[model samples]
Every structure is written in C-alpha cells, then in structure tokens.
Target: MDQDLNVVRGDSPDWRPPNKLLGQYLLSRLKLHGDRIIQAYPQYNETVTAAVVAERAVRYAATLQSLGVGCGDRVVVCCGIHPHYSSLLLGTICCGAACATLNNKFDSGDLRRLMEIIQPKVVFSMSDAVPQLQPALSQLATIPKLIVLDDEDTWKWFINNKIAYHEPQGIDPYTNVAAIMCSSGTSGLPKAVQITQANLFTSLMAFKHKDAYVQADDIVVITSPLFWVTALLYSLASMDHGVLLVLEFGASEEHVLGVIQQQKATVLFTASNFALSIAKQPSLNSYDFSRLRIVIATGTAMAMDTQILVENFFGASVVQLYGMTEILIATGMTRKGQRILGSVGLLVPTMKLKIVDPNTGISQGCGKVGELLFKGPQVSPGYLNNPEATAATFDAEGWVHSGDIGYADSDGNIFVTGRIKDIMKYRGHHVSPIELESILLSHPEVLEAAVIGVPHPTDVEHPRAYVVLKPGASVTADSLAELVASQVAEHKWLHGGVCFVNSLPKSPTGKIIRSELRYLTES
Candidate 1:
C-alpha cells in the first residue's frame, strides 16, 4: 500500500442530474431541429429528418403499449442496418420498457444465451436475422413475440397502426432500467449490462454540458452498427446535439471515401481497426477531407503510426476513447484535456477513477501500474440475471474493477497497457501483448498484428505474433520476429515464433480475440 492514494477525480465531478427519462430527453432535443437531417443510410437510400424520429417514437410507444409492453418489461432488437433503428429503440424506452440490442453478426448460440438472460417480451428482428434467431427464440422457456422490422405488413400493423396511448406514469428515471447492452469482453462470453434511464441521460448530458462538443452542422459519419454500445453512445450524443448522422453499413473503402468527400462529414467515429484499414488505402490520401475535424477511435487502442496517419489524412484531432458497456463515459479526449499520444486521455467529467493493486488490495500511486477501478453516475447498475458476475467485478464500495493494467502519468493521462488476464507470463516475467503488438504495428509491412501467449513446455507461456500483412507486402516471418526481439527484453521476445494470417479473429467491436488466437496455436 503506497501512502499516496492514486485516485483521480474529474475537474467537474458528476452531480445529481435532472430526473429525465432517456427517451424523452432524446425526442425533446432531436425534434427541436425539426427539418434538419437526423440520419442518412445509403443501404436504403434513406434520409430521416428529426421530425420523423420524434413522431415515430410517439407512435411506436403507443403500439408497444397496445402489445402489452409496460414499465419494467424488456424488448430485444436484432435489426441490421435499419435506418429507423434509433427511433425503435427510443420508442421502446419511451413506452416504459427497456430494450436490449443484439449484434447481428453473433452466432445463434450467443444470441440464445443473451435471449435467455434478457427474457424479453418482444423482439424487433430484421427480416433476414429472424431465421437465425428463430431457433433460439423457440428454445426459450417463455418465447417472445417476434416482430420483423423490414416486413411492410408487420411494420404497418405493429408500429404505425396504434395511435391512442398515454404516457407512462409514476416512473423513476434513476432506478428504472432503460437499455441493456451486451458487453463484449476480451476473454469470455458477453454479459448483458443493465443501464438505467438516469445512466443514459446523465452520460449524454455530460457530453452535452461538459467536454466533448458537437456542432449542430457536424455530419457525424458512423460506420459501426447501432448494436455496439460505443456506436450507441456516439449516436445518442450526435442526436442530442442535433448533429446530422451519416450511418454506413458494410461500406467499401472507396465508398467510405466517396461518402466523406460527398457528405463533407466533420466527425468520423468508428473502431481503430476499421480506421487503420482505411487509412492504408491509397485512394484515401486523394480525398479532400477538409471538413473532417474529429476522428474518434473506439474498440482497440490505436497504434502511434496508425493514429498519426488518420490525423494527417483527415486533418482531424484523433480522439481515442476508453469506454465500455458498463460505463458510458470513463475516459475520453475532452476540450479541457487534449489526448497524449498512446494514452486514453483524461477521465471525463462524469467519472472518478482509482488505480489499485489487484493482489495486495492497496491503492497505487501515480506512474505505478495497477488494475483500474471506476465509479460514476453513468456506470451501469449490474449485469442482467448475472449476480455472480456483478458481485465479482463491482465491489460493495461501488468501484467497478476494470481488470485493465495501466498507470497514470503526471498530467493524469491514463494509458491502458493490456487487460490483467491478457498479460503473458513467460517464466515468471510479466509481458504485455499490447506492448509487443505496438512494436509489430510500427512495421511498414504489417497491416495489423495480435500477440498471444502460446503454451510452452519449459516456460509458462511464450509470446507469439499473429500478423496480417498489407496487400502485396513481402516481409518474411523471421524479419518481423527479429524486429521485436531487438527492441524488447529477452523475456518479452517472440519465443513462440511468428505466423502471418490473412486476418486475426476479432470481436464485433473490432478488438482482437486473443483467446481465439491461442486456439489457433493449439490447432
């Protein structure tokens, strides 16, 4: 236990915010812009106005009420690339029912487990996704009524049909659940995080009133699907700020460039992997990104070289955010504190953070690496139907153990090295995969890289590199292995050797699945 308490509080700590429901807040703010374009999706050739979202919310809420969905009830949404996705989610919340969004890419097994946990009363699945989720829905003890969002008949009969319904009364925004987003962790099955109305409202307010500023005219281009928590956070913030949102689904690199040039998008928000991949495209340098001012990177930490490329290419401030499904705003680059390279920036106004020694149960000091713990107004209450997981991670004192290994510098810039579980133990020497991965990513030939611990007979585990080369790159494996070996200590060397793959397995969030890489080594 160090005498110095390594706790950091935001300059403007969170206070008791207004007791407003998330749906009401969104609709109220979004409708003010009226004719301003709220959302644009190329897949449907759709452009939605603020007025449409507000109107649809009221109508959809009535329909949900008619279908027997009341306060405290749950609804599941598996709509893929649906332009009205935001409206539907808002409607579910406005109608006094919490909603859970499923990643459309999730296998049937993952979908079934989440369905069992949420126990939703109704599911709004995309027409194509229904077949995949139908098997899981059938296995549920209490099957939820499935509503296909794309079907014209269902859309009319279920959503636009109901007109008469009253606002939910006696609702407590602070305690009542509003949204349950599944957390895609690095090494385990996803857990459904229960977010209250207050959590969502407070988080959006934090961005609105405090640090991250969004202009009314900013066309925020979002490539990640709406199901992702990070995407939802950005989407809600953009809407609340009355910024135009441009949503792209499975866009080609050339198509993305065309969107940026045509729309003159001001803010580009997506995962680091996606950003990095596009930054490497030769055509990207040709685009006139004069309007792009902010590039927000999520999912994985951006390597220095890749970050620099994005900043140079877009002429934008690269904001790499460190947030999770549990806490909507943990740390992010703010107006007060611009990001330090390789750091996740300072804690936002809504959060208070502490770094604690995991094994010793003692608080660490500045510049000392330890597991990070967080407590805040926007932090989720707990996991849905998973009290054991809730108890294990969230302490009685209200600190949620982040399980991340990191330290803060003198200026309070937090750099996340890697997860505690992801640290490779090579003959009692602790090695960070992120440390090695960064070195590999610096190489010109490497497009992307993931380091994982391979089982070693004599040593505990050896660090191995799984790399994806750039198109037409011809670097040998030994050259890349020697690159790491020359820079790091012997213990951190790539003893398990290096292997090049077309691509590394990744979570829907764009985080590399090292556990899957370990399986690759075994097989």
Candidate 2:
C-alpha cells in the first residue's frame, strides 16, 4: 500500500508497467477506498464496495482450491452479467486457474463444443442456465462439478458452510493463463483465446494514459455483455482504478440512458448501434447527460456522421476504439487529443502495428491498404486447444494477423477500411464494402446497411448492398444505388446491385453478419 500503485506513471498516453500481477494489482487497491462503492447493478438494485469484492474474490479463490482447481486448470463461467460472475472470474484467476468465459446466449450445440475444448475442471452457471448446461457438461469426457449461482445452498456450501479457508495461490504473471476469451467466430468456428495475466495487466496499464485515465470519482457504465472483450476489460480497469463501475446487464438504450442520468455517469462504453439508438431517441434532450466526459464507441465502426451526432447529442467527446479478442486494445481516440473524423485514433504504446500486403505478406508503407498485424504484450498467447489455428493466425515473426484492412495516417492514427476477407473485387480492382456501407448509413432514410461481394461473369466479384431503412422511411434500391454511384469511384460502385431489407443480421456485439449477407446474396 505504501508503494505508488498507479498502473501508469507518465504524463503522456504511454504505459509503464507496475510490475505487479493483475490479481496482485487488483487486490492491492483494497488498501484504499475499501468502503467506497466499486460496482452498482441497477437491474438488481445491488451495490458492492471494494472491500466486499476483494473478500468475496479471496473466499472464492480458496473455494476453487479446495475443489482441486490448481494452476493452469480451466474453470468455465456461463452466466449473465452479475457481481457474483465477476467474483468467480477474479477468484478463478486468483487461484492460478484459467477462466473460460462462455457466452450465456450460446445454444446447446455451441456450449457443448466450447466445453469439449475447454474441458474445464469446474463449471459455474446461473440456476437458469443449469438446465441447458447439464447435457453439455455431461457430454464432456470428464464431467465437471456444476455450481449453480442462484441456489442458496451454493453459497452455504462454497462460502458459509466452510470452516477453514485455503490460502490463495500466486501465479506467474507472464505464463499463467488468466482468462480464455472466445473469438466472435463470424468467419468460422469460435476459438478460445488464451489471455495471460501479463496481457490483462498490460491492458489495464494502457488506461492509465493521460487522455484515458479514470479518476476515483468517475462512474463508468458498461452495457455490452461481459463475454465481449471490450466490456470485460473496461470493468476490470475501472475496478483497478478504484472508480465506481456500473453493470447495466444488457439493458435497452432508454434504460441505460436513465441509469446514466441517475448515476451521473462520467464515462460510458457501448456498441455503435446502442449509441445510435441513444442519438435517435426523440426525448434525448430531456436527459441530464452534462456530467459525461467521454462516451466510447467500440465493437464495430460507427459512421462518421453518427459519431459526430452522438458527440453533439451528449455534449461529450465520442471516441472510437479498435481492438479484438486476440488483442485487448490497439488504438483508441483520446479525450483531450486530436480526434480524426474517421480514424480509430493513435496506437497504444504497448503494441506495434503494420499494414501488410495480403497476397504477398509484405509490409506496406503508410496510407496503403493491407492486412493489419499487431505485435505486443497485449496480444493473446494463442488459441487454446487448437495449435493449427494458432499457427495459421500468428506468424513466425510473432506478428498476429488482424484480418483487417486499413491504413494509417502520418500522425499514426488508423483508419479501418474493412476486413481482408470482406474485400470485393470488381473489374480486377479491389473494393472495400465498408466505404459503400458508410455512404449508405449517411443517408437520412437508412438506419443500417451491409455490403458484400457477389459473383459476376466479367467483374469476377461485384459489390452488392443490403440496406435497412428507418421506420416509415421509403427508399428505392435504384435511388440508393444512384446516391452511392454519385459518391464513389466507378469500380467501387455497386455493380451487383442493391436490395432493401427489414433488418441485417448482426452478432451479439452489433457487428454485421457479413457471412449471412453473402449467403442471402448468393441465394
């Protein structure tokens, strides 16, 4: 406690490692502000302080140890957003165990597949989820001990009924797998990404930078599911900073806005769609959002106009962040720094970024569209239980392929164009669907849009678009195509044509399901 526990100690947005393990760092903060409210759950009307979280985490860690969970063992957590879930995650890591977070919304088949890969030593879930998880847990070659959260007997058995508490075990910060996060699996099957203790601690340190710093009085609201990397890391960072954290439990935009008004939240993190919904709220002006200092847009890219509109609507700086499950956060816009209109902002100090030619695997200079590659401590060790995937994605030189195509400006600000796999070819020229989709979203009548490449005889693959219009707003495909044609190059135009739809498929984090779009177009 006597030592300066600030994860970062610098004036700029540069990270300085605190030389402490993530669990060590989190527990060390208990020396200060132990009685201060650390987390608030409006859905349950529950509030917990730093002292209680630390105590619960330690007790849970001891409980896991008693269940034969040791260093490097896997513990699967399948539950919705709850304080107990956070406690379980921290406790699992504190006991030198790897916590594999399962998406609570996953179907039985997906659950079974992930469990088979994780082969967790112990499985924890809410009582409601136990029914579905039972069969999946049984399918595992080794049946894991199931712990249901909603049962009072669970607490009595794990905490209240226990007499002697086992001591928490220490972990190797660099080698210990603190958590296993699941990839989005938009392109293929979901793989478990192994995140090391050092990876998470480095991610936490990235927040201590000047423009992204969290003050002790800051109230941070997180609406994204805890399974998503963005929300999970932000919650941990807020707790590490001894700041108030609010878990909104996947609430509606209106409900979230109410919580922000009531809690006087200073920082908010949500997906672009949620931000868009908040922006489009007719009664948005009635809310007291003056206390907000920054609203971060992540999970997917926000349209340039939408970002500006949200910033103006909230009277707060709206910044875009770029990162994936493999990497915690690579680029972010600063509250007080220069924010480019369509860029994800300056690269973090912890990682190195390069744009490489997709076909030749050669590094491209600035302003060239190429596959983005990242190398740093924040990058996950590799995919768990799949050496082939680990080898396929990570190169021998240690660079992890991001599968994204984007270029950086002279100032090091990144402009994400589109996914490498999502690129379209027309007339032997490359086209990025995001450029066209962004144009469509800018239209006043369109609420959302997705673009993909469809097969063509001469053009090989031509651009096709699917658009969702705002309620009662009618727009013809010919008119939308004309609008896009007027704004883009001939080759980039929608040669494969356009279609109007009620809605586009989306992942849980709000990213467009391009594969589904491709399927629909092909069909």
Compare the candidates by lDDT and give the number of the best one.
1
- What is each predicted model's overall lDDT from 0 to 1? 0.80, 0.79
TM-score (all chains, Cα) for each model: 0.94, 0.93
Q: Whole-model lDDT for model 1 versus the true structure? A: 0.80
Residue pairs in steric clash, candidate 2?
none
Candidate 1 residues lying further than 4 Å off, grouped into runs, are 1-4, 13-16, 184-187, 335-337
lDDT of 2: 0.79
Q: Which ten-residue region of model 2 has the weakest summed lDDT?
A: 1-10
* lDDT tens digits by residue: candidate 2, 490-512: 99888888888888898877778
- TM-score winner among the candidates? 1
Model 2 Cα shift for residue 179 (angstroms)? 0.6
